[model samples]
Target chain A: MGDRERRVVFVTVGTTCFDALVKAVDSEEVKQALLRKGYTDLLIQMGRGTYVPSKDSGKLNLQVDHFTFSPSIADYIREASLVISHAGSGSIFETLRLGKPLIVVVNEDLMDNHQSELAEELAERNHLFCSRPQTLQETVEAMDLDALQPYMPGEAKPVVALINKFLGFPV
Target chain B: MGLDAFAAACCAIPVLASLLAVRFAYVLCRSGLPPTRPRAAGLRCLIVLGSGGHTAEMMNIITELQKDRFTPRYYVAALTDSMSLQKAQVYEKSLIQGEGEKIIKNAQFMQIYRSREVGQSYITSIATTLLAVLHALWLIIRIRPQVIFCNGPGTCIPLCASAFLLKVLGLGWSSIFYIESIARVKKLSLSGLLLYKLRISDQFFVQWTQLQQKYPRAQYAGRLM
Candidate 1:
């Protein structure tokens, strides 16, 4: 199959239920855009959420695959061409490690706003794109996977060095 | 020099004088040489794992260690965190397979109550932390671990504190080492703040050079994972 034919978008809010993100993705506007872009497949992993797409939102009700939670989201992420995720550090890092086109959406309701801080820094470095619920649709359409900055994994595991230093050896 | 001159000179070099005074009084001392590791007998290492992200980061650190030197491991996971426990076990299994030798022989797993549960209030958190500390003291007594290790996690506060208290009481020989998470580019987490503020860890490590520059005492060992 052609790349476009197999393209899927994976949307996950990490291990917590996020109704806002799920709602935004389930809207008629997003479905129309995805249909126009030849994204025939979309998967949503909504943890502990109350909302479901139901019979509204056009074709999304017929084709979208969603679940309350999954043991591993990595498999789904690996299979997808694009990842839309909550701005959790772990999720962002995993996406970067896999070198996928990423759009980070922040849940502002979080206590620390730590996600906003992280997403802003990452966006500043051209590592990924950050969007809020209001702008997610436009951000998704504007993303160019080839133009995004690729993440380089770090070497020189500090844990071993730390352990060595404590053990009285020069790290 | 005269007594007045000597006093003035000592005050000028207060740091050096303090070190000398402490040595003279034998009031403060560094731990003796750590036990040789990776021998056929091996050293007992207790590695604490936090939930999710903390667990993932800690795994990278563990696998990076020379697996042959440490064996008969112990893992501390939060009471409800099967995720961390499973990850630890999976890493060990993969390590053993890679080496074609037993990297971890019957690694022990223990669970401790989390200091802060989901939706818990500040008051409840304080009570939980105190309870975890008590549990940690008992674990230290029973395990008598030679090396205790953790990165940044709220659950680590009680465990590391207990290890420090045990060493100070002359009741244990465990050396505690804390590594600030790589995600912590500028500031330390709550656990990092507690350990850094008190200087409890024998050697605290930061992944980024920027953090090392900010906290001169923290060793910049280069990035990991």
Candidate 2:
């Protein structure tokens, strides 16, 4: 009979198959951690990954939901209190711009692993937390909300100004 | 006497061709060096949107553009990339809703031939690349956009090449602006490399300081994401 606001954690892997991160977050320990942190809902955008979360919905008191893909993940990201995502720049920047606390799980299976460079740089700047699949649990357990600084989204004014200047347009 | 004249003419032809080639190279190198050009009332802006992250970054930059000045925007995306075009359409729709229906009157979407497909062999890729270049040349000639803005993607190479050819021939002046993708924190993409090495872009921007340090010509734009 009582209704309360639902706190959600959104996990997304973009358009790639990252079963490692999906499976890591599906564990009982991670779900229990989310519950302890007062998060009531867990939504996962699995992308092409074949793994379906097997956690029981009734016993844990935490709602677990997932889908293969969506037309727009921004809506889900906006609804989430926290975000766990792959190191894809699109997801990382989107989450950061939305001012959500993010944990980026780098996919080691990717060739060249160029995604790590952006992740590490942002993480070093205290913009987001970076983790590997093996260390995601530890990251989830140890993440402190107070440690993050609000990210300032970049402006296109400089680039636009340069373009206007190059064309001899009035400043 | 006729045979002697013909032989002299043949030698002159090769010399003239070599001289012309040198002049062409000079013009290409000197392109994008002018501080300013004659201002126009309205400009044709050609925007190149690549797959995934490139498209997202470009959209971010485009949102900051002066919509009134850059009239009749042309969005170019790869034929195989459906999502980019869809995103462009959605963006235009939002603009229309906010401003009015007139905002989309001149906006157009163009699909270009992909230069190469994934897992395609190098031998066949060369042929496809040439075909794509020819298609792009035709598009460039028809569009004659005054300014071309592109980020990382193979699709932009042909279009940039065609625009550069026009600049060399003095047929049209399309100032090419190339922005290095943010995903490349340390290095430039292949398209970025060709644009930089060949000096095709009038304004080259890199999002990271390290990349700008490594490539002196590239101006660090401070993370335009």
Instruction: State which candidate has the highest DockQ.
Output: 2
* Clash list (residue pairs), candidate 2: none
Instruction: Go through the candidates in order and give the C-alpha RMSD of each one to the true structure.
Output: 7.5, 2.8
**Fnat for every candidate:** 0.39, 0.60
lDDT of 1: 0.75
The interface root mean square deviation of candidate 1 comes to 3.6
Q: Per-residue lDDT of B1-225 in model 2, one digit per residue for the tens?
A: 999999999999999888779868876767666545568657888999998888988998888887888878999999999899999999988999888879998699999998898769999999998889999999999999888999998899999999888877778888899999888888788899999998989899999898999999998867777
Name the 10 consecutive residues with the lowest summed lDDT in model 1 chain B.
B24-33
Task: Report the lDDT tens digits of candidate 1 across residue range B1-225.
Answer: 699999988787987767666643331235323435533435578899986667777877777766545556889998888889998988777776766655566477889888778798998788887888888878878887767778877777878777766666557767777878776776777788788877777678887677788988788876655
User: Once superposed on the true structure, which residue ranges of model 1 sit more than 4 Å away at CA?
Assistant: A1-4, A33-38, A55-62, A156-158, A169-171, B1-41, B96-106, B122-126
Quote the positional error of residue B209 for candidate 2 in Å: 2.3
